[model samples]
Target: MTTLIAEDLLLLLLDDVKGTPTSSYLDVALGGALLLELALAEAVHVRERTSVWSSAKVDVAPGAVVSDPVLADALGRVAERERAASDLVTRLGKGTRDALTARLAERGVLRREDDRVLGLFPRTRWPEADGRHEDEIRARLTAVLVQGLDPDPRTGALVALLHAVGAAPSAVDRGGVPARDVRRRAKEVAEGTWAAKAVRDAITASTAAMSAVMAATTAAAAAGS
Candidate 1:
């Protein structure tokens, strides 16, 4: 699943760079890398259960009740958080692509120029044409890139909580720190207190709204079929 998601993301990045000069390949590559991280996070969330295992087999863990509502609610919250992260990933991908195009245009690199000498010049030469302009473009791109690439504090915290409930293994390794401990720390970093609850509520509401839309679309398609 990860491999498929990575390939799909690479293709999307390539499409975004299509028609741009080869000289700008490095820029496109860097942008694509950042985009890929965001995409992976989203993909992980969207396909969390299916991607990890064929079936969610819960071990009774010696005298644990399987029909606990609290446990069920916790599981539901995790799913909702994943859905929200997936939605954010889609939004961020579009925003990043659009921002890249706009920045390139502002830098005058979007248009084809007829000057043979300038055409032969390196990519750095064009940026030297207007240092201040290039700086501004870089600044704007950096700001957007940082925001979208990093995990949202709220969601990250929620993921940490889910890890606790599920006893999930940590994706990152820290020596001497147990996986659960690391996840709990991450949750602390992502959520201070009240904000996490608010974010949880928002995710729950958004999931319901999005599910309704998807169901309606599926039903309409089925009717037509």
Candidate 2:
């Protein structure tokens, strides 16, 4: 079974049968997942002892051979210099969703079909090919959010990602996990050590930054309207 965080995040973003993402939020969320994966793998990180989170230096762990082309590319860019978590999130998020979708399709979890936008511009659609694996993933999240069970590091990270992207409600709806419980338990997971302290700190800072950007955008749109 492909147990990469990216794979799991992709599964959650996509429908079990349709294989389509629940929303555009999946894009940035998956980018956060990628950075978390690097943190978990000790491949990249933000510096410690920085008074400000935004100005903290982001660096790749020395000598890590990231196998995924997408990851490798990200590492190369992130390694170039230090940047704020929000800045890195914006930079790292580019291309992550499509890369993960391709990876999932390669694993047979989904299949890509040629299509067109409005029956005009060329497009591609990913439909679910297999669901058992994703079902297992959902079951674990169910256990955590509904059963009040302690999640393993991987599951914990997934819980954090789902909540980070505002998908927690839908993710737990099938099992009827309460929104309150989802928020409470998801906090525990996010606070838990799914990775090194440095990595965990990075995830927290990055997600917060992303949320702020979303809020500001919404406020700006409201004002404009």
Best by TM-score: 2
lDDT of 2 by residue, 1-225 (tens): 855776788877876655568866666776677777777677887775456433555677789778877777877778778776667777777887777778878888888888777889987777788878888988888888878788776777788888777776567644555677778777777777656687677767667766766677679889999
lDDT of candidates 1 onward, in order: 0.32, 0.74
- Candidate 2 lands at a TM-score of 0.86
Error of 2 at 108 (Å): 1.3
lDDT per residue for candidate 1 within 43-89, as digits (tens), equals 21122235432321111122322232322332333434323332332
RMSD to true structure for each model, in Å: 17.8, 2.5
lDDT of model 2 at residue 88? 73
Alpha-carbon runs more than 4 Å astray in model 1: 1-195
User: Where does candidate 2 stray beyond 4 Å?
Assistant: 52-55, 193-195, 223-225
